[model samples]
Target: MDKLALTFELSYYLWGLLTLTIPIAIHLLSKHRGKLVPFAHIALIKVKNSPQLNQARLTQWLLLILRLLMLLVACAILAQLVWSKNADTSANLVLVSNDWLAQSSDAEKQQLFEDLNSSQNSRLFIIDGLNQSLSQRKLESKALLAFQGDTSSTTTPPLNIWANLAEISKTLPKAQKIQLYTTNRLNQFTGQKVAITNPIEWHIKSLPNTLPETKLTASLTIVSDANYQQQLLYVRGALDALATTLPLDLNIEYLDSSLVQEDLDLSQQQSHIIYLADAPLPTELVNSATSIISSEQLQGYTQADFPLTLATKLFAAQTKQWFADNARLSNQQITELPNLDLVNQQQTNTGNAQSLHLWLILILVILFMTERLLSEWPNKHSRQVEGN
Candidate 1:
């Protein structure tokens, strides 16, 4: 049997719904202050002892509705209200990958598709290495009918879908359970193993199969000035330690003290360069390097042609000055790959509901402007009539 329910992504934001009363208060205040004030005509006009409810005309209904809609939308956005077929934590959200489907029989694939398509209680999503939930909108349109899953590509790219179910779940409204139908690839699970507090219930489609693998390989170069040799050794040792943990082909090179950033070999396939200096690195090293030298940092906002980053501190046990730099370097290098982000991810609601809020706020602003115009229409009409 199919189940249906509506849920809020951020139930906490429902508290903002209390603000709806503000518009009502404003409407009442405006009416109370609409009391007639006369000077020359005061002698002819009689002041009523008791104000009647009918005395306050109700012509601003459109304006009131517009203002009310703005508040309602704001509250809806804050609440992140979404309609879920099943709101249970146990509700199954199945993320299917291409590799898993490839190993299955045609009959089995058809059955899986029919079952998911028939069930209103579960959602079927398509996933691959480079994309997650390829046809989210398309799936919704089809009434969420599951097939073996859609073809995500012309060629099945090598996949390392490590904890991909957990990532997709984070983006979805919090549910009781999630499952990934995939083959076990070691690359999918290469990140540091920590017990997931809210782990995805992994459902293996078949025994693990080996996919074509890619290694993180980079050549490193260091300034060979005698003054920085000791620090350079620390950097080398740290790089080697990082290299051992993954499939990395590392090559080392040296730069003379007189060598400038322009002296760097631009044609080399090395992905990164390290500049060890007492001062900041020159910008030209980024140009001569085939590898992008920039990282996601904000020291200097200069946009370089290649990925460049100002060299960060590399701490060794021998140096008591800064030991945490080792951890930073390790983390930065791993992020150049996948799966590591999950191990380091701080547990929070994974869905980005900000876009929801943004769209609602935009509508609310438009409604506010319309409401203002509506409220002034009567005044404008009155002025024109008096002038005629």
Candidate 2:
């Protein structure tokens, strides 16, 4: 049996406790006020203690106490008094990499869902990367409905699981245990692995070698003057590096600015042209190329000043767009793999805390019924006394 801890899921409703005075004030103000009557024969009058009147006064106080109790219980129910367990207590924090979900097969996804459902107190979190920041969102076991479709063409970058883990560790409570479900794709494991004090049980899924074999054909025609030879070298080197990572059979050709012609196959509708010269190319060369990157677009930076990686990425992106039929490959090149065997397997079987709302609701119902019966009891007793 899970060790449950009592907590208020929505403690804001506890503010209603202040309203307990409302019933108290009403009970005090509702006292029966006797009218002052002018009595001429005060010496002949006698006063005696009546048991019925004393019993009636006691019942009124009892009714007041019950009303107060009812109000207090209602507030507790609204506050969602729950019996919950945290990660350190027993619950397991299950973190699922969205990248893994996108790449995983249907059978694998179904198996994951089954595991989550069978786990006693597992909290599911979907790990996603946006703008180089990792954000996690809680998910139910059945929330994988959208993952059943084909998402093979998603262009999102592979997550740096190790770096993300470091960030996650900072925000986690002390001594929490984590069950991480992710792919063991080397590209997904980027950056340095830091030591996390929390115990993590790695459920690493090996990815199949599905690298594309079909090489895309891309041609680049550089039109530049002799003065821009160094700029040409930078462009050429960047493209060479791009070709190795991307499955592309790239072809490069050079043209002198003065030798350009209007009828030249510069805009062959298939090639992308990179103009490196300071002089603007003829309208024919500009209009002919399928896509052109002019000197102005490069920010007029010299070869030494130009950002090679940035230029390469821009070129690679353009190539991918131009040849949409080719398979898009992940740009991350695997360096070193982490030691998965070193991970501690301290997995826990805890789930969401059991809710006490039902019990509170039942108590509220009983309070209402008892309050109604007691409220009528005094009136019923008085009628019987009059009949006597």
Candidate 3:
């Protein structure tokens, strides 16, 4: 059996339905009354009922009904009624975290695939750290192979599983079951716990102690002249400290004259360049390097804290990449879950609303034309009878 759900976009417009009483009041108040005629004798006059009288009475009732229907349809249009059929309850929606797929062994992957394939109505969705939006795909062998590659390069913050579930549940039909397949790594759960409106069967795979690591390498060049020799020492010290802690390589260069073609070539090879001179960097070098920091940036820092400040700035720039390489999985354990009743239930699909609007507009037009014709029909018939 198909279940029907009705929703209103502008619910306040439903107040217009109160106007339907106006036509009914007019119908009762404007009832046709016979006029008084002066006569010499009561027996001299014979009362004869006109055939058009019955037609007029019938038309009056029809017009009232038509007017009431027109008002109702108009109110429905303003309210923007949305009609949707609930999806099949037997169908299953499976959400798989990309982090789990990246760390899971081949045997585990095969077992998961077999379990989902056994359920013919199951649909698959992959949730990755990079993209928060859900992308639906078929549960096939080839599709599973595509997700096997290293996702660490594109990793952002830890995946917020509860938040994603809260958002995705809004679009799904009520009573439709959802199954979530993810790892039990605590680092992967970063955000605050959200209310789970939909009941989700959790398939948490325990992660191993050691996960795969991603290594990052970059070339850094520091160019300084005699004028900024003192500042250069602090910058080099900062670079040395950064090299030990971060996966970075420093290629220090000191130039007294303007950068030549060879200097530009070296700059091209380096990923980032720090220019600690008064003169502006050459347009060629600026365009060749991925990022360039000028001496003007060192204005606020005192000489005493210059090395620490410089190191902090450099680390901040590469924080995202550092997290990607080092923090692949967290060691924390999940102790308790959030309250499910707090999940937000009010969810709407834009596509369904738009399609419903188009349909209602068509019905409104047809009702309007029919009411106009019915309103004029009684008058036209009365005139024909009087002429004859």
Candidate 4:
């Protein structure tokens, strides 16, 4: 198999390269101005040694080169030039979910391995509870045996390992085809949708399992806007009693008017929510709600341009303990593998800019020291005696 390779790409502030002309222009414009004295014979002095003229010309050229190098180095530092090592684009990534090969004959397994080896860039990984690369497992026979002997069954909830799809997505070094091998068990799926920015062509082999559907518990959260202080208190009184009566975990939130318009962030582990607010919610917030109460009992409009509204009932029938008892058994997080949506909302970039800066600094110092040594070497020789 061909080794995993990276291509080198360089990026810098392009305008900095144009500054190279500055040093060359100075070298061309500056000429030695000679103080000439009146003389009877311009030819009296022996013709200046040809060797000395050649040596002086050589010195000027060397000095020009050194000065230009110094300027270029400084510009590079300011431009923050960086080199990026990118993974091979043409390489194929094949994730062999063990379930795909579980029931296949030995001949099929051999054929699959042969097909993979045919492509120089094909890399295979096995995914179940963990993603293990075939390269690391060296012994193909042992790896296949291990896959067949997988004891982490989805039938038992406590023994089952819930593979976090969001976390799995982050482990991917680059965008590639994703394959999942598993039995169709409800416990394996996440409570919420997983949103991945990468465009992965998913190939799944979900073998039907004998396990019954895993029952999930539910949570109820209530949020009220600041303008409705009296309303918030009334809702809390009703729900707080329901929490004790039905033994339900009730989370209550009161947001100020300034903070009310902000979108509420949700996670797979979190409960479905009920929001009571007067202001119009953002598109995302409206879509996330299980239920919303935008107003109360009374409603009226003045004959003029004035608007008036009132509510006769502070707590409705839906806000009672009976509704919460039924809500606890709702199937909010159950789904099959393909349409499963488990979201990992945290985003972090992997680049280390500080490390790059340190490397550039080290190179710049080395170039400065080299230039200094070369500049003073010619003078040191000039100071020595001719016949020493």
- C-alpha RMSD (angstroms) for model 2: 11.8
lDDT tens digits, residues 124-199, model 3? 8876643444544334544775567474444434667777776776665656678888776655677677665567
Model 2 TM: 0.42
C-alpha RMSD for every candidate: 15.4, 11.8, 5.9, 15.4
lDDT of 1 by residue, 263-338 (tens): 6453364445555555445555555544433222223323341112222322121122122211122222322333
- Alpha-carbon deviation at 190 in model 4, angstroms: 4.5
Candidate 3: which stretches are off by over 4 Å? Answer: 1-54, 71-75, 114-121, 128-136, 141-147, 150-167, 174-177, 183-218, 240-248, 258-262, 299-308, 312-319, 328-369
Candidate models: Cα lDDT each: 0.52, 0.67, 0.67, 0.47
Q: Residue 178 in model 1: shift from native, Å?
A: 4.6
Query: What TM-score number comes out for model 3?
Result: 0.67
Off by over 4 Å in 2: 1-88, 130-136, 149-151, 154-156, 224-255, 259-388
Better of 3 and 4 by lDDT: 3
- Model 3, CA-based lDDT: 0.67
Question: What digit string (tens of lDDT, one per residue) describes model 4 on residues 85-153?
Answer: 333446665555444455445665676567667777765555554444334523343254344533343
Clashes of each: 8, 5, 0, 7
Sorting all predicted structures by TM-score, with the top scorer first, yields 3, 4, 2, 1
